[model samples]
Target chain A: MSAIATPLAREPVLSLRGVNKRFGAVQALTDVHIDVAAGEVVALVGDNGAGKSTLVKVIAGVYQPDSGDIRFSGINVTVGGPGEAQALGIATVFQDLALCDNLDVVANLFLGREDLAGGLLNEVKMEKEAWRLLRTLSAKIPSVRIPIAALSGGQRQTVAIARSLVGDPKVVMLDEPTAALGVAQTAEVLNMIERLREHGLGVILISHNMADVQAVADRIVVLRLGRNAAEFRVEEATTDQLVAAITGASDNVVAARAERRRTDGAEAQLEEGNSDG
Target chain B: MADTEQTHTVADDLADERLIRVQGLSGLVHMTWNRLRSGELGSLPVVVGLVVISILFYAMEPRFLSSRSLVSITQFAAPIGIIALGIVLVLLLGQIDLSVGSVSGLAAAGMAVLVVRHGYSELVGIMAALTVGLLIGAVYAVLHNRLGVPSFVFSLAGLLGFQGLLLYVLGRQGTINLPSGSFLVEFTRFKFVTGLTSYVLVLAVVAVFLATQLWGIRTRTRAGLSAPGQGAVLIKVGLLAVGLLVLTWYVNLDRGWSYLWLFFVFLVVVMDLLLRRTRWGRHVFAVGGNEEAARRSGVKVGRIYFTVFASCSMLAAVGGLLAAGLQTSVSQASGTTDTNLTAIAAAVIGGTSLFGGRGSAYSAMLGIIVLQAIQSGLNMVGVDSSVRFMVTGGVLLLAVAIDSVSRRARSSSGRG
Candidate 1:
């Protein structure tokens, strides 16, 4: 199993080669090479501003990278915008979800691409498709016709995921799928990710929770200082090793721990000062 | 070694999550129902004011409930009600159409000229009037959408400009008396089924509406579409039916039914269908809800804006034609300043939210009935016209206050 986990073993559905993204003078992403293969769950993890978001946005076609090539199914493609990316079967579920709160789940699911019949919206057809998507995801919501405002946090996430699958995308990227959820809700979302993999879909799950990553991820990729720092199979990696790789302290871990202690002390002092005023 | 335990844990967690979500949705529905039953339907205060005004009118004249007086009230309300319908659409999109009065005036003038001055047939004249009104509306929509100007400013400008153009069209003639025996008069006067017949028709139409809504809910539920619970759907339909029956009983007590009122009601229902069931209607709601979001969703927001403005103008034209039929003439002073404000007030008072994405054309009828009832009732009791303005303004303010308060409550309860 470990021998077959190498990059050369499987063809990648989406691949980014040495992508570099800069915002004016700040380099947001540098020399990032990542690949998402079909039927695989790749966990992208990093601390804040480590270029994880930048890399995902590039793949989602929100921004054009300053340099590097993006390949889709082995064909080099230039994705112009979100619409173009959607056409190419690449769906990104942003943290905000981009859902209309006033609209019901069915309406939101078929919002831009509603089914039509006889020059009018075929409500029946859209409703059927929305139901199918929800059922396939094993979403336990009571009904799909209720407004999103009435949905719980986890159900809302399910709707967002279902929306992404509506276009039958080759890749689905979830940004912080369980960020604000409670324990049970997190587990539900994890189950959903597993279902997506079972359906032979490529998924890129971005999260700050190590527990969540361990539960769902097949492979773990760490980003540090806008660069790929380390890659490891979830079965062979431990939480401590992953932490060390993320913080650039894998070698001489004890000295790195001492330095982190000093920084924590200064950060706490600054936070206290701000709160006091 | 831990696979079985993990699977069991996952199953338990999924069940718990489902329970929480179900609880949340039920709570939301319960809160919304409580608010609606408590008279927090956006214009609760105005509705109360209407009831008070009716009571006062009844006290002044026992004849207020008489069939003849009731007929007069509905007759006067017909044209204004039609205009109010258009206003409701604009308000639903969180917009205003100030040009309705002018659009009405121009349409009346055009119809009169085409029939009386140009010696054309009345049917041709009516068609021409509607077409012209639609054209004007389209132009306004284009201007508003393409230029990205606020609807109020452009529509206000249209009010003045169109009024001037109407006066020009009616040049030298000032007022043109319509032929009494013409098709326009016959069409307006045409009444199918007398008193009981009218009441029955109204009831039937209301029944059809309720049935369709219920059927839609049931079909959606069967398809596993997200729908309100069966109880909620039943409650909504029951409330709507009761309201419709009450209004029908009142209107039918007097003159059976005003053909004019029925015509306007038909127009409003068609417009509602256009907004709620069609692609164009969906686009309008989307643009109104969040312009940026709608644009990103691939809707041509600009084109929708144009279409809304144009449709509003067309509705105004229809109102104008109706007014001309009632008066049997087109006058230069046909559309007063009060006309525009009253139409807008009717929409707002009919439960159409000023915040957009939440209203219906039925609001126009409700709003116009409330306002016109007050006007006619006051006239019967010999109240000064000036005092009527103060009362209407007061009602408007009270409605707005109720709207704001209810909105706050909805948001706080996490149900809005």
Candidate 2:
């Protein structure tokens, strides 16, 4: 059930408050608070091992937060396990995609949730549903019966994202869905993210590609050293600002040394644009 | 295929989904070529290997392909074939039951002792032996789930421990002869379907296969989903019928078709259906393919592992019982000598991937036959166990190497 009483739809679909996680001596995440409203796309960006994945896992219920209150639809809920997280209408497409290569597209699409008729797999119905899902995304898969091993990276990603829809979740978290994808495939995935937004579902996109993030994300949340570094409105934030936040360039020794050069570089870019005009 | 969408009457826009149904003979051929080029070998390698090996063996020894030789070879494959089915299921999950050989032997030993020494009826003794298998499986599952002991280690322990238990139960005799008039012995030894019955059964199989295929096409087509054409269905059903009839005729040429071997094949077929056409089978492949993914998807990983391990042991028990029935006795070497290697080798050779989530139940049948043929042919050529063991091991390696190489070829070709 969603909180639909508010006409403005400003209430966050999912909100994390002071969440913290530790793996022994290493604090993977700390005091991480992020919120997403319905129909909003939130981009999570971080360098390698900045705890973006750890935070995603916590939200997805793969790892329970050490101390935090996770509120979904303005209600506090305990994410004890992935099952509970899924039951709470949060669907996650992890970084690995997690598809069985030996199984065909239909099998992969309906892995845990298969429709059975008379105690046997209703392949006909499932296959039909599979085609419908693929068509909705305009996915160009050749066949639904071929094993997942035969699918391209884009098709596999589509299958994983489409599988998440089988549950019709409110919050959809995609962990680097465009990683290792070609240009066209990346565009296809971006279109899917926009589609999720159009469907009035909260979309969480975790990515390393700044171009992809700035292209589709409404708001970007950057993580640095297990903490929230900065948040930016996509319309106003410059690439340099995003990069500065990601690399913590404000106080970095090398970044400070290049600060005057950065200003000069910006003026030089304006002169170049003037000459071009 | 896209053109067909337009040509075909529009029943529902929702049902008008795209399927790569290549029409005409050439298009079908083109599709198959694409699959083969991508390393979707399926039973191709086994069929080719069977032919090559059969020819080479026949050239070396004229009696290699004789009907009588084939009969004995098939009989030899029955028990291991049944055992290999369990291996296929376990391998699909990327797990193993190293204790299967010992488990089977223990079951036979237990059955013989209870029936011959304690004078229990054969049925009760057999059930008791199978129940022991179930309990042993549960123990393995518990050790795996609760103690965090890996299946390989636990089954390794079971292998040694079960073999010791078998020896201890025999109590210095080390062997027990099954009763001659016992139903178990008699049934396994002389039970064969008459040729008439076998042909009828083959017809029934063909009929059911065709009916299902037609029904599937009808359902999908009616639902506005793309379905295989009637032409393709007929072709597939035709090939299957011809293959079954040829196999039935070949086996019947000997001592008719053994009902026991049919039973083994039946189990494999049923398991194939369960693995391919049921939700549980999909879960098995999912859990085996990626345990973490399966868990995140809400699949009960522990339960899947438990059921596979338990069913594997149960099948091993039945395989052991069949072996005992074949010899009419349980001995120290009943499950000892070559059963373990042969059964595992059969599975691998039949194109089942050792890496898991990539095997079929029917591979058990194909792989076992190839293995038994090698052993039988080597016997005909006066090759001793030294050569037999070496050859079998070499063949297993070859199969695995081929599997890996083809997998690489597939990846390089951008199939994944």
Candidate 3:
């Protein structure tokens, strides 16, 4: 139990510092610093082209940061590519999910790291493991043998998420998981994220849906214009404050107005309490 | 699409026959119809097409169904089928090998030059020919994998260049007859499994099939997974056993079944297992289905490409040897005329997707048989070669059309 550091109360599983990525004429990311603690859900929210995807891609090792230090479990590490990132116990679920639609769920789940018995795919074992993974996530897949083409978007999402767990990845990053899901499906995904957190794994959720982010995230980190704008405890942050941090500058009018209203309301409540006393 | 349909649980979609479960024969029909509506044709179109073509050809020429004719068809389909097997592998990776024909031709020419012109033994000549195949594939792999050249361009260049090599090997003489008593000629022309051997082989295949299928049922049932019914498995196996026995009986009537035919079947079975049961097979499909996804999964993309190209070229060399043996001569035209396209055509016609990531080894077996049937039927009917080509082109188009339509149906049916 001591060996497994709970993501919520333990040291950060991953830390990024001064990460910058430049693509020819455009600077995709600049000095992006992020910390994802074990057993914690970190929701990363940003506007379109606010370098959210770029930052995530950098961490996933899809793109190398121009100059940055990435530390995993307090040790500085270099994630040269997705494979290396995977080896470092970092799993990424990109926007596309990167699934082979032609393959069955079991095959897709055990695609690269297949358990072999006597030089052949141990199909029985793979299928059993797939079921176990999905069962843990409460994924509503009908059968493991059916091709991905037969599954719905929500089911596919769950399958992809389940696939990420095959190698016991410590850090799971999900990009826009609930973007296209319906009400029930969204709830299901949110529930899965909570389950992942309970397993002592650190979760980095990238989503546009504030309601979703607000529901599952323990901490909200806002990015604007390729840089970290604000970080807040989910318990302390309001919708307006989070939105304001996501949309523009630190001193945005909407957030200021929301703050004034909050202070005035608190003052009025204090005066009423004095009269009652 | 309608939200109600879009919201179907994947369990309901399994009714479309993507994977067999319950409902017996009616369930099977319902599944096939549903799959067709959704455009997930699998190999149904080609299977039905083969049956229809055979019936139509047999009606036109009774001789088309003769034991001798059937045996001949198997022999003819064997070389092309073997080449098509390699084609299916490459096609699964969404790649093509246009140089297969030229590589094969060069091999035959090399074999002839060594055995006839240079007084080399048959074993040495055969080794040299196969080595040529391996080298060609390795070269193709290097150019495509290391240099980042697309396989299409690399193999196309191979088509023209290897033809030059083939011509060079046969310089001053356009043709050379394989010696009558030599191993290459004798084995290709004369070798056949005895009637008893065919019976034994059929029984063994049936026994293996039944045992494996039953074993699977036991495992799945014990694991509490939704296993395909044992009755369905037994029936399928039973029918397969009958088919094999009948095929053996027919071939045995005319000087027994050729070892070449048996050899081809053996390759199919081995390859089938490799693709379905082995890690290498899984990698191939993954690389074919989504290259980026597979790479991210830690599959070595470059090595897979290299090995596949090399294997395809090696198979092409084997096909070339078959062609030389069948004709009893190695000539400039040994592997050139229609060989490149035809091998690929057979694979597509058999139901291997040209777009990749969805096919089986049996596809080559079924595909070559269809093409061979068409050719054999037309030849017996005295159809002109020009007209035959047109008809062949039409059938290929029809097969492609069915595939496209079925795929569209699948996506629209919310199966995507």
Candidate 4:
């Protein structure tokens, strides 16, 4: 039991410092610094092109940072591809999830890493393990034998999460985990993330839903114009303050008011054009 | 109050136990029905098509369903069926292998040159043929995987290249007849039992294999593993039994039965096991489903592509060898256009989804039978060869269109 760290107060499990990524002429990410401690959930929020995806891609090994360094477990690491990241116990569940819906839940969970015995796939072992994993996450489905196509969006998300944990990954990054789920399903997925944190795994969550971030995120890192704008502890910030920080108007009340005035002016012009037409 | 409490406790216990029993039972039933409805149970359309064709052929000529005709059909279907099995794998991965017909021709030519011209042993000739097929397949796979070429183009090139090689090998010798020998005559010509008995033997083998598979699945489920529902298993076995029984009955109608069809079925089963039970097989499925995802998952995607191409070529070679054995001769005109088109059509018609990641070897066998039946039926009805080609082409188009449409629907529904 001592071998497993508690879900609080630990060294940074993964840290990215001064990371920058440029694609051709445009810089997708700039000077991004984020750290996820053991058992901590870090929510990364930004506008449409705020580099949320680029940042996650860098950590997931989809893109290599042109500058800055990545440190995992206090050791500087070079991640060439997703495989390398996986080897380092970093699992990223993208929006697509990369699951074969034609296959049953167990088959999807053990897609490439099926258990083998006597030179044959040990279906029994794989099935049992799948069951155990689901049980641990407290994912309730009718049966684990059903194809993923038959599952709801929430269940499918659960399956993807289970697949990521198959190798017992240290860092689990989920992109819009509840974006397609209903109210109940969103709650279920949030609960699962809480459970993952309780197990002492560092979680990086990318979401547009402020409510979700406030509910689950321990630390909220706001990105504005491809750079870190502000970092807030959930207890120290209100919804208005977070929104202000994201919109780049947290420091000046007059600027925030002016920006609102400009938005209203644009809306009035659109309405005037509609009436004239 | 104590009596009331005891009654309440008893009711609660009964309800709990009943719920467990009911869940288990419903799970089994639900799974079985699902399997039955899915194309996994062997598409009903294919089965009905075969039956309808058989009846029509029988009506045209009473002897068409006789023992001799049945034997002939099996012998014809054997080589084609073997090739179709390989096509099934390619199809399951959502690809095509157009080189099989030419690969088969090249293999037969190679075998003939080795054994008859080079004065090599029959075993050496067969080995040479198989090796050549495998090498050709490997090259195609590499080109597709490493170079990122579509399988269709890679195999199309193989088709042309191998066919040219076959013509080159034959040279001035337009035909080569295999020498009649004990091994050749016994294995190719001998019948283990007469008429109905032979069909029974074939059916028995199929039943045993299916039973073993079902038992294995059950044990996995009982061990708390995630296995397809018992209902699905039963439905699968039931469909297989019905199919084999019908085929046997048809062949047994005549007093003579050929073991050639059984051999073809065996080949299909072996290929199925290779794809389902082996690491190589899983890799092929993965590569087909999403090559990028599979590569990210640490699979040697390039190697799998290469291996699958090689396997298809090898199967093509085996088909050619069997065809030569049945005819006792390899001719210049052997393995014409029908060979390639029919094999692809058979795989698609048999329920090997053109979209990949969801098909079986048995589908190939069903597809082959359907195509052959169409050819044979049309000929018996006095339809010209030209018209037959057009009909087959149309059917192939329809099958492909349906497959693609269904795949799109499934994906859009967020099922895939």
Point out where model 4 deviates above 4 Å: A1-8, A18-31, A66-69, A250-277, B1-41, B182-186, B189-218, B225-259, B378-384, B394-416
Tens-digit lDDT track of model 3 for B1-416: 33235324333224233345647688888877776767777778888988898899888988998989988898888988989999999999999898889999999899989999999898888889889988888887788777988889988999999999899999988999998887766666799886788799889989998998988888766654556777788889989999989888887889778877878888988989988889989999999999988987888988888888878888888888878888889988878859888898888888888888988999899888888889999999889888778878988899888767776776677564
Q: Estimate each model's TM-score.
A: 0.80, 0.89, 0.89, 0.83
| TM-score of chain A, model number 1 | 0.89
Among the candidates, what TM-score does chain A have in each? 0.89, 0.87, 0.86, 0.87
Error of 3 at A197 (Å): 1.2
Task: Give per-residue lDDT, candidate 4, residue B269.
Answer: 77
Q: Chain B, model 2, TM-score against the native? A: 0.94
Candidate ranking (TM-score, best to worst): 3, 2, 4, 1
lDDT of 2 by residue, A1-277 (tens): 1111222349899999999999999999989989999999999998888899999989988898899999999999999878788889999998899998777888888888899999999988888788777766666677777778878899899999999888889999999999989999999999988988988999999999999999999888889999998888788677777777888775665467678788999999999999999
Which tens-of-lDDT digit does each residue in B1-416 have in candidate 2? 46347535643333334654466899989988988888778888888999999999999998998877877787778998998998898888887778889999999999999999999999998998899889888898888878989778998899899999989888888889998888777767888875789889989999999998888878877887767778888989999999988877887788866767878988988999999888889899888878877877778889988899899899999999989999999999978747876777888899888888888998999999998899999999997989988999888998998889878877776553
Worst 10 residues of 3 chain B by lDDT: B6-15
Candidate 2 off by > 4 Å: A1-9, A17-33, A46-51, A65-69, A222-230, A240-277, B1-21, B57-64, B246-250, B381-383
Rank ordering of all candidates by DockQ, starting from the highest: 2, 3, 4, 1
User: Could you report the Cα RMSD, in angstroms, for every candidate shown?
Assistant: 6.8, 4.5, 6.6, 6.9
CAPRI classification of candidate 3: acceptable
**Residue B62 of candidate 2: its Cα lDDT?**
83
> Which one wins by lDDT: 2 or 4?
2
Give the top-scoring candidate (DockQ): 2
* lDDT of model 4 at position A236: 72
lDDT order, best first, reads 2, 3, 1, 4
Two-chain DockQ for model 1: 0.21
lDDT for B365 in candidate 3 is 94
Better of 2 and 4 by DockQ: 2
